[model samples]
Target: MMEKAYAKINLILDIVGKRPDGYHELKSLMIPIDFYDELYFEPSDQVELISNVDIHNNAILKTVQLIKDTYHIQRGVKITLNKRIPLGAGLAGGSADISATIRGLNRLWGLNLPNRALTQLANALGSDTLFCLYNQRAVIYGRGDQISILPPGKPIQNITLVCPNIPVLTKDVFGVFEKAVAHDFEIVYNTYLVTKKESLLYNDLLEPAFKVSPKLKDIYNHLVSLGLKPHLSGSGSTCFLFDLTEDQKNLLKNIDDVTIIDTQEHQ
Candidate 1:
């Protein structure tokens, strides 16, 4: 079985507060993009993974073990991961892969588990994993596990994703993050629904991410100096902009040691 794990961007991310569990309460509008990683699964006696890049502290294996223990299935899986999404780009690549594993293993093992059951498994991983399981536009709340899947809004177009070589760990950013006054997400939410534009889009993590990696701040400044309005995806080193002109695209090509992906919101 093969699964495609899609990448995502946060159109609106607001950190509401820190919880007693050391997790932050947040509200966000997240959407998937065309960028993805591919995973192919086959039956095996022991769980195994082969990826183009070496993975340390892999969540894929953890997910495999969870499934085996929960279902008491003796069979194992060999997963071949074709990684495309850059790690630590605020793209939730890791969580997406974990969610993909859940879906792939369900079919591979013939568990016939419903979405709710799959969601239960995903919840153990993280809130991002839960969103990736559905891979749709939603208003994510409460540490990201509470999802309000929205009706298909206006499709986002002309997306240019700039992924820097720098990897900004989410934890590190959040460690330095200070809670900010919450935005009324309803306004941002309703405005996007009506206008199909992100004129009011914002990400609270940008400040902390910049603090975590000053070099990333430099990149953001450079993009801004080029007359581009770039938005940070999550706890990001990667930044994205919409509707770039050919000249603007050419200007972006001059940046060193960055991957530029031309994509759009996945419909």
Candidate 2:
């Protein structure tokens, strides 16, 4: 079976608090994108995993092991992965792939689990994994596990994502928020209302991220200079320009050493 794992972006994000478990509570409107990673699964006599990337912390293999350990099924499986989503871009690529694996393996093994059960398991893999299981626009809270179906709001603009070959640590991003704990619930909730208001919806992480990677500031400043208001996606590294026409897209294509991905709200 071949399955495609999609990417996600935080339309609006805020840090609510840090849980006792050390996980940060967040309020964010998350939307899935068409960017994907491919996974191929086949029934095997023994459980095994192989991948294109080295995968030192192999989520696919770990997911298979986790399912067996949790569900205690004696099924054999094999997974082959084709990774396209840029790593550490806050795009939830690994989580998406794991969700797809769970879905595909459940089907291949005749597990017949419901979406709710699958979501529960997805959470075990990662907080974002559950959203990928549902794979839709959602109001995300509680470590990204408490997901609520959002109103089918009017679609936003076409997006162009450019990852500046730098990895921004999500934990560090949340940690920064934890220490500061800006009481800007106004900024937090405005974006959730899903209107055309632009200013408050932007991420406050930009200041800290620019401090860490001046190159990120360089990329962001360039996008802004082009008359496009871009926001840092999730934690960092991947910045996006919204609502570009074909001519604008061609203009961005002229830039050197940029990874441009054409994206829209996943319908």
Candidate 3:
């Protein structure tokens, strides 16, 4: 069986509060993009993970183990990952991979688990994994486990994603943000009612992301100097510009240490 794990971008991310368990409460509008990583699975006696990227602390491994232990399934599977999405770019690549694995294995093993059961299992993997299972635009809240699916809004066309070479850890970004200020939840539910073009877009982690890697601010400024309105995707490193002209796309192609991804093609 083959599954595609699509990447995602946070259109608007805001910190609501902190939970007693030390997890931060979050409210955000998240959408899946065309960019994806592919996972191939086949039945085997022993579970195995094959990938070019580093497998240490890999979410896929954890997901497989969790499934086996949770269900008491002795069957094993061989999984191969064809990695296209860049790692550590705040694009939820790892989360997507785990979600895909859960969904794929459920079918492969004939588990026939209900969506609610799958969602519950996904939540145990990571904050963003449950959202990935839906693979559509939605409002995510309560540490990203509670999801409310939205009707398809105005499509965000011609998006150009620029992923910087620098690596930014999500935990590091959140650590800096927590120390800087206390964020109060705004009436952001209204923002989701508008079209993608008309919605007020923002990321609360932007300032702290800059603190984590000052070079990201430099990249943002450079893109602005080119007469482009670029916003950080989620946490850091990857910035996206919407409705770019062909000339602008060509110009951005010349920049070093950057990858240009078009979301329209994926749509």
Candidate 4:
């Protein structure tokens, strides 16, 4: 089976608190965008993973191993990952790949596992992995394992993501954030309850991300100068501009060191 792993953008991300285990508690509104990476799976005598990028420590390989060990299945599968999502852009590219693998293997191996079972495995792999399994807009909380799917509000259309070539590691961003001032969750929660307006979208990690990558601020400022409202997606180097006019789109097309992707939800 072939599966497409869709990238996601965070509409709003607020850090609630830190846990005793050192993981940060978070509340985020995330939507799966149209950009994707493709994975192909075929039955094999032994597990094999192929990718242009490094595979030895790839999330997809880790997921494959986890499934075999947990299920005690001797069956192996060959996986081909054609990656499109940029790494370390806070796009959840790796998480999406693992989600796709788990979903595809469930059917290819005829495991017949329930969604809850798959979600359990996904949560173990990564916090964002569970959300990727659903491939829908959701408000995620508690280290990203807890998810509440949002009712279909308005479909997000005409989103343009400007991913600077620089990659910002999630851990690094959080590390800086630990020392930085945090946002008020009460305010964030109330805002989310009231509306999904693009103007209200915010990310608490932006300040720390700017600290980690100074150039990110320049990009943010540049977008603002162009009369565009750009917000960081997750702990990101990728900033999103929503509802861009045709002229603004043309202006972005001329910019350098940035990759642009249009938003499309997975069918």
Candidate 5:
């Protein structure tokens, strides 16, 4: 069985408040992009994973163990992952993998677990894993487990992403995060609703992410210098721009030392 795990970008990220449980309450718009990782599964006597990239403290392993214990399954499987998503770029690569594993194993083992069960498993794995299970454009709330699928609007097109080679830790960024005022969130949200302008979108985590890594701030300023308005995705290291012209796309290609990803290009 093969499963595709699509990476996600947070177009709008707002920090509502810090919960007592240490997880910050968030309201963000998250969408899965065309870029993805592939996982191939084969039945085996023991659970084993082979991947193109080395992920420390892999959540996929935990997900597999969770499913086995939850369903009381004695069977094991060997999984091979062709990882394409860039790690720690504020893209939910790990969460996507976890969700894919859940789905892949469900089909492989014929568990027939319902959506609710899958969601429960996802929620336990991480904040963004639940969102990956659906892979739709949605507004996520309350530490990212609560998902509200937005009414279908125009599809996002000409999406270009600039991912710096550095990795930014989400926990590190959140640790130093300063919550934005409720008024700021209201204005940004309302403005985007009315205009559908990418520039109107806001990320409360940007300042904290910059604080965690000054180099990210430097990159942001550099993009601005080139007359581009880039919005930070999720926490840090990756910034995205929408509706770029052909000239702007070429300009991005000339940028040194950054990975450029374009989405929704027509053949």
Candidate 6:
């Protein structure tokens, strides 16, 4: 069984409130994009896992072990992860890959789980896992598992992402949002809700994300300077410039450690 794990972007993200579980409540439009990591499940005689990236870091290996202990399943899956999405870039590459793995293994091992059951498994790994399971444009809330799929709306135009050769920890970016330093969420939310002639895109994580990683800020500002609507993907590091011109794509080729991925607005 092979699973293709996709990457997602938060077209608009707002930390609405703090949850009772010490996690912040959030509202965001999440869209899975073209970038993906491939997972191949090989059923073998022995229980084992392998990946090009570190096995300790591969979520498939770790989650499989967790499922094994919890379910006492008879079958085992040998996983091979081909990591393409950059790690720690606010892309949810890790979580998405894990979600894909869980989905793949369920079938390969003959678990015959329903979507809801798979989603329950997703929640055990991370709140964002459920979004990955759906792999469509959705409005996510309450720790990111409470997803409501939206009807097909305006298609997203072209966007280019530039990720500097550095990692931006998603947890650290969220910490900045919750700290006593204070930030404005109301203004951003107001901006997000306005339906427009074109697609409305915004990321509340931008200000604080750039604060920690100035290079990421540089990329964001650079895009804005060029009259492109720019937003940070997920938490930080990956900055997306929307509706680009041919010249912009040509210019993007000159940047270091950047990849141009075609993205769609999931509705």
TM-score for each candidate, following the candidate numbering:
0.97, 0.90, 0.93, 0.94, 0.94, 0.87
Best to worst by lDDT, what's the order?
Answer: 1, 5, 4, 3, 2, 6
Backbone clash total, candidate 1? 0
lDDT of 5 by residue, 3-48 (tens): 9898888878888889999899998877788888999999999999
Tens digits of per-residue lDDT for model 1 on 18-126?
Answer: 9999899999999999899999999998889999987798899999999999999999899999999998899999999999999999999999998788989999998
Q: Least lDDT summed over 10 consecutive residues: which range in candidate 5?
A: 181-190
- Model 3: ten consecutive residues of lowest lDDT: 179-188
* Tens digit per residue, CA lDDT, model 2, 20-96: 99887777777888788999999898877777777668788888988888888887898889988878787888889
Inter-residue clash pairs, candidate 6: 137-266
Q: How far is 201's C-alpha from truth in model 1 (Å)?
A: 0.4
Q: For candidate 2, give the lDDT.
A: 0.79
Q: What is the lDDT of residue 127 in candidate 2?
A: 78
Which candidate tops lDDT? 1
Number of the top candidate by TM-score? Answer: 1
lDDT tens digits by residue: candidate 6, 1-267: 799888888877777667788888888877787778898888876667767877355567778877777678777778888888888888888888889988887878888888888888898898778988878877888898798876545656565677667889877887787433333544543455455422455666777787788877777777677666667888878877667778877877766666666565534
Q: List CA RMSD, all candidates.
A: 1.0, 2.3, 2.1, 1.9, 2.1, 3.1
Clash count per candidate: 0, 0, 0, 1, 0, 1
Instruction: List the global CA lDDT of all models.
Output: 0.91, 0.79, 0.84, 0.86, 0.87, 0.76
lDDT of 4 by residue, 1-267 (tens): 899998998888888768998999998888898898999999999999888777447988889889999999899999999988989998999899999999989989999999889989999999899889988888899999999987656667788889998889999999988534566655764576567566767788999999899888888888999988998999998998878888898898877888987775544
lDDT of 3 by residue, 1-267 (tens): 899998998877887667898888898888898889999999999999999787568889899999999999999999999988888788899899999999889988999999989999999999999889879888899999999888776667777899998888888988888544443434554544553443367788889899999888888888989888888877878998788889999889767788888884233
